[model samples]
Target: METLLINEQFVSQFKYWREGQVRTGMRFRRNLFEYVSKFNHHQRHHAFDLAWKLAQAGKESIVTATSDSYTIWVNLRVVCPAALPSWSNSGLEVGAFEPASPGLVPLEAVLSA
Candidate 1:
């Protein structure tokens, strides 16, 4: 998810958010679906962990931690993908090294950036 976050930020001024199917087989309806569907297992794990924590806290709106924060919207990731792929369709795991890093990021950090 970190790579994805960076990728998205890197691609930020491009408006590629409206990006359509790279091929003829996939026709994504929403930008958020397209965005999250790209995350790998580690990313998904991190995302689910975050979502679970948010839901557990009784935060009714799962959009962004901040009301005006446009960084990410939870509803998009939570309910959009037609089928979640391993990682941005790249099929790469979050940690390929011998010792994997922790999967979860603090909510404060996620919300901060």
Candidate 2:
């Protein structure tokens, strides 16, 4: 019964905490589901190892340890079509747009200058 509870907890965590992969149909989700189905909670301590395997295969990803409550290791990776925008000089500035402020500058004015 304890193992079942653990498995339930793991599934819940994976479903919600890792929703992105599951929703997007990423390979990681399938791999993890298979792992969970094949092994009990006691034998499923390879989240980091699996992440490492992905990274070693030349995939751009990230891995990190999860909260201490459950498993010792948890990894998260997100793959997008384009990580950044291709457009250059989009006239986006970090500071506020308050015209009254002397030092403040609007991106539009800067771009036009």
For lDDT, the strongest prediction is 1
lDDT on C-alpha atoms for all candidate structures: 0.29, 0.27
| lDDT, residue 85, model 1 | 37
Highest TM-score: give the candidate number: 2
- In Å, residue 26's CA in model 2 sits off its true spot by 14
Q: Residue 30 error for model 2, in Å? A: 26
lDDT assessment of candidate 2: 0.27
> For model 2, how does the per-residue alpha-carbon lDDT over 34-98 read when each residue is reduced to its tens digit?
11111223333443344344445444432222232122112223233242122111332122111
**What TM-score against the true fold does each predicted structure earn?**
0.22, 0.23
Tens-place lDDT per residue, model 1, 68-94, is: 122222333343334333223244323
Clashes of each: 5, 0
Task: Report lDDT (Cα) of residue 44, candidate 2.
Answer: 34
